[model samples]
Target: MFDKYLIDVATLRNTGPADAPTGFAFEAKLGYYRGLGLSMIEKLDVSIDGEQLPREAVRFDEGNGPLSLDEMETAYDRRWPFGTPATILIERPGGFPPGEHELSLLQQLRVSYLPFPSTNSDAKSVSFPG
Candidate 1:
């Protein structure tokens, strides 16, 4: 049987002068399979204006660690079970042009028994400078 999970965009902030900081928060509810033993593979993808941002594999509950924003991708093997809630935050670089920008959050879940990882799920998008 497959397990249920969720990918939520807890918050988004744009800190710059002239342009007010835009914040967004949302949650995604879904399901997946419960893996065996003590490790589950998870991947998170963040993009802005269709361009991928640099991200490091860090605990969702814990803020971005020592890794810089140029790391590209973040992957990790967790000891948590399926259906766990993970929160993510995406911060835009300062000086973003005064216009609408598309922000997307993509997530992938993998189980131990499954040969290949599950399909990517699309949560929702937020527009800034509206």
Candidate 2:
């Protein structure tokens, strides 16, 4: 099965005093059956302003076991701890220009006994006035 996830740009942080990179973050929820021992098996695909961005996957253990199903929320906000939002650097190829941008997340999962089930939220787009 396949699933699609969208990130909200409003939640991204862009203002701060320290030099930091600009990027978006968000939480993903996964549900699994008992003894399936299924886990997230890949990194997230990130895209900004219609362009693909390089991203590092940060995984957190929610403590839910193989027999349990629950929802997990992750931070999807982007910000620069030291520099202005405009000056913040992005590791992805050809960073976005000063204007409206759209960010998205894509991932694949593995299940032991059952077919993978997937779902997605609506895509979100935001504008940054130059």
Candidate 3:
């Protein structure tokens, strides 16, 4: 139900030092109705224009500072509140060039009542900031 808002287009931009960006990022809202802790995130895969980024090249931050995918595994204290957008950053050395490209996010989250983790994903064509 919250898939449409998974990625906020306005927040998509290059990140890191202004003079030499190390990556690109966008704000991503949880697709679930309720919030979940960072530890409950079982999977988070990112791809741009059909090319999947390496597992170690992604990081997540919901205002608690940036954490690598591995660090998020034990971040039980960090909670991703409902309706709040987290920044999903990708390390691309110089960030993506300015233009329209397909950005995709796939996430698997463990929930209390469900026997299996819930999977949510969304993709959209967005223009990268110059």
* Model 2 misplacement above 4 A: 1-6, 15-39, 55-97, 115-122
Predictions in order: lDDT: 0.43, 0.35, 0.89
Candidates sorted on lDDT, descending: 3, 1, 2
Among all windows of 10 consecutive residues in model 2, the one with the lowest summed lDDT is 79-88
Model 3 residue pairs with clashes: none
Instruction: Give me the candidate number with maximum TM-score.
Output: 3
Question: Per-residue lDDT tens digits of candidate 1, residues 74-108?
Answer: 42432334455444444443533345666555556
State the lDDT of candidate 2 residue by residue for 28-114, as single tens digits: 333222222223333334556565554432322223311111211222222112111111123322223357667555534343443
Task: Work out the TM-score per prediction.
Answer: 0.50, 0.43, 0.93
For all candidates, the clash counts are: 7, 12, 0
Tens digits of per-residue lDDT for model 3 on 5-98? 8888788888888888899998999989999999999888989898889989999999989999999999989999999989999999888667
Model 1: per-residue Cα lDDT at residue 89: 42
Worst 10 residues of 1 by lDDT: 63-72
Instruction: Tell me the TM-score of model 1.
Output: 0.50
Maximum-lDDT candidate? 3
